[model samples]
Target chain A: MASTHLKRTSLYDVHRAAGARMVEFGGWEMPVQYAGIVEEHHAVRTAAGLFDVSHMGEVEVFGPGALESVQRLITNDAARLIPGQGLYSPVCLPSGGIIDDLTVFRLTGDRFLFVVNASRTERDFQWIAEHTRAATARDRSADLALLALQGPKAQSILERLTRADLTRLASFHFTDGLEVAGLRCLVARTGYTGEDGFEIACAWDAAPALWSALVEAGRPHGLAPAGLGARDTLRLEAGYMLYGNDIDETATPLEAPLGWTVKFDKVAFIGREALLAQKARGVARKLVGFEMQGRAVPRHGYALQAEGRRIGQVTSGTFGPWIRKSIGMGYVERAYAPPGTPLQVEIRGRLEDARVVKLPFYRRS
Target chain B: MYPKDLRYSSEHEWARAEGGRVRVGITRFAADRLTDVVFVELPAVGAKVTYMQPFGVVESVKAVSDLYSPVSGTVVEVNAALADTPEVVNSDPYGKGWMIVVQPDDLRELEQLMPVEKYLGLIGEPAT
Candidate 1:
């Protein structure tokens, strides 16, 4: 693999120095693990874990047309969001194909910030910019760094460093220009992990200092430095969709079963017509979670079968560390989408028994 | 931590000669790379294995890798313990983690494998 073209995050040296195993992810040379995937995964579930999510892209849109652009670009109702609130939504093409999944934060009446997937950063920025003539969309991915402190102990650990009243910061709300560890940051009470956590955004060059501060403060709380490997497992257990894997341009939001995210009651948005038509016709296939009956691990691209006939394909699969089961998600025929439906996953040419289960293999207590 | 008494293959399998039979298991370096092995699939007793060929598979939470046989022979014994707790391969890769014991066609084939020092060099471990 020619990794010469891979990008590096601001905390690259810190991860390397800590003996993290680096791998190419979404065009960035990111750490796959620091200690171990399972160990880091449990830490996030039990205690707390810090993550370098700086590889995710950030786009800033501001002007009179900011709300208009956001409402037109995403499937969700951005108008419902007050300033300092964020909502997760899927950016879709006019044909209803998913362009990217991202979170849009309304900074002000006219300014919005979008946190997008790393690989789709450029594409999402171009698409969002082209749709907006009254507003200006600028990609600020290179100028910012994002860190996630997640788990049961996240709030306490973060409180030790920042004076912000975390108890008052509701979910999906952010506090801007907050001083954490003697540095300015934008802290959001949001995270990909299904736990109470914060995603802190800071200047790119200041990331190392923030990381070190969090690591030092988190030591007493049993916090571990997590990587992309643990992040994938964590999100998988949470039943979150990964853009390139669980969703893509080939799969529409309806097929992804992310219908709850689509707001048809709101004004017209991209893919509104196609999605409305599909919603009326009902989706043919729906993404469902399944658990393996045998010890075999179901992997991505594996065939999902029922009665010796192919029903669908596995989009994302993993040995969920916290759940202690082989859990995966796949798009199956709507008839087989029930929680108790029996299914078979083909692994290395051998059919393994599995059962369709409810989404989210694990939840934080 | 390459053991001096064990011979290693380029695939990172360690072999120990015990009379006419050779014990096989992955090295610590390989286990560290795999990390938190969740499941292991091993061949049954009396199964035929070829030298440098995949005998079974080792799966971690994040990855799945093949376990190559270090010697060609009939598998006289297999590690049944790993069927329930495959993480032994990560915790004790060289001792209790031994995968299979094969009665090799010729014990001289063991010499074809690299010595501990050479294997460590191949893995880019600085002399220590």
Candidate 2:
């Protein structure tokens, strides 16, 4: 029995009307697909795709210490984020284990917003609130709805609906009060698919209107209303880690190969000491991207074997629709983390051949 | 859509009898649930399979599922074409998407499977 109450987005009715296949994901009854997974995945890559990311959580931080609190809470250098800019970071426990991977937007010099994972909303908010002394943290997950319009045609499609000069909105920059489809929304030129796109954040109840407008305006551009299924594959192809899947409480950012997110120079943050120690001693095991040598689909929890021994386990694996290869990511002994290292993933009792490759399996051309 | 001439298993496999050999594949309902099937692993020809047992694997980008056998038999043929172009399973699940042909050990085994009407009922589809 599902004990936890499942949440639904404001676009729930619209998704149902569109004949989306619904599935329970991280305590939310969300649409996993609309047209089809591969179809929607292709649409996002080739043209454009709209996504309902309403289930993702948002934590608002305000007050004089907002910048200080955010800097201390995350592994990345949030102080480097100028107003109207956002940066991805990992919220880590004091033990250096990842609490969540979130994006912090600097709305003002003293105001910040942390966009967190749906499942980690409560944990991240509590962690952030407890650690901050002067800044106030409020969970705004219920107040906001996020939509991501991604792909090559994303800018052109969104341009038709809004008068704003999106071309001037550089990547990782956001305008909090941009009017889109006659509604004031926060539009960010950031995306998870490694493509040029915009993440539109609007009031919770206005998502349906925004969604319908985007769908209508994007009709000529071949925009598909994609769902979680396509979202997963897109992120995977881009080598973006899914919190619970690729990184978790037991894995540190260094082990996750997310050392770039850890800024050791910034006035001592959580997990800074432990990460420094890990760096000095060298990470015992490291995450690496891999491609299957055969057709066997390596999946989560599958073992990574090398030299007749189990080296580590697969964290995430899938047949990437865009890349058209069986690609995956997993932690392996530091020795086997190098690109081109031979490896094997035990799938369904058989040791299938695999080899470590680069992090991203696909890059937008 | 479930065809009337075929028999179906509760696991969503369809078996169409061609004399003693039954052509087997997943139903449209199953294919829809497993959207964008990218890879299919079928049993080799002459491999033995049991009734209601897993005979192969069908993997989509999101998940992997087993293909259940509808009757005890030996694999006579496999849709090797699926290895290169598995999306056909989503487009033509009943025709070019056929997974295997099995020579049943017992001809009467077909009767144990559900009729199209019963299968539609099993999947909560309105039986016409």
Write one digit per residue (lDDT tens) for candidate 1, span A199-315: 999999999999999999999999999999999999999999999999998788989968889999999999999999988999899999999996778888999999889999999
List TM-scores of chain B, every candidate: 0.97, 0.98
Q: Which stretches of candidate 1 lie over 4 Å from their true place?
A: none
- Summarize candidate 2's per-residue lDDT along B17-126 as a digit string, tens digits: 99779999999999988888988999999999999999999999988999999999899999999999898999999999999999999979989999999999988999
Q: RMSD, model 2, all Cα superposed?
A: 1.1
Candidate 2, residue A84: the lDDT equals 98
RMSD of each: 1.1, 1.1
TM-score of every model versus the real structure: 0.98, 0.98
Residue A322 error, candidate 2, Å: 1.0
- Fraction of the true interface contacts (Cα pairs closer than 8 Å across chains) found in each model: 0.80, 0.85
CAPRI quality band, candidate 1: high
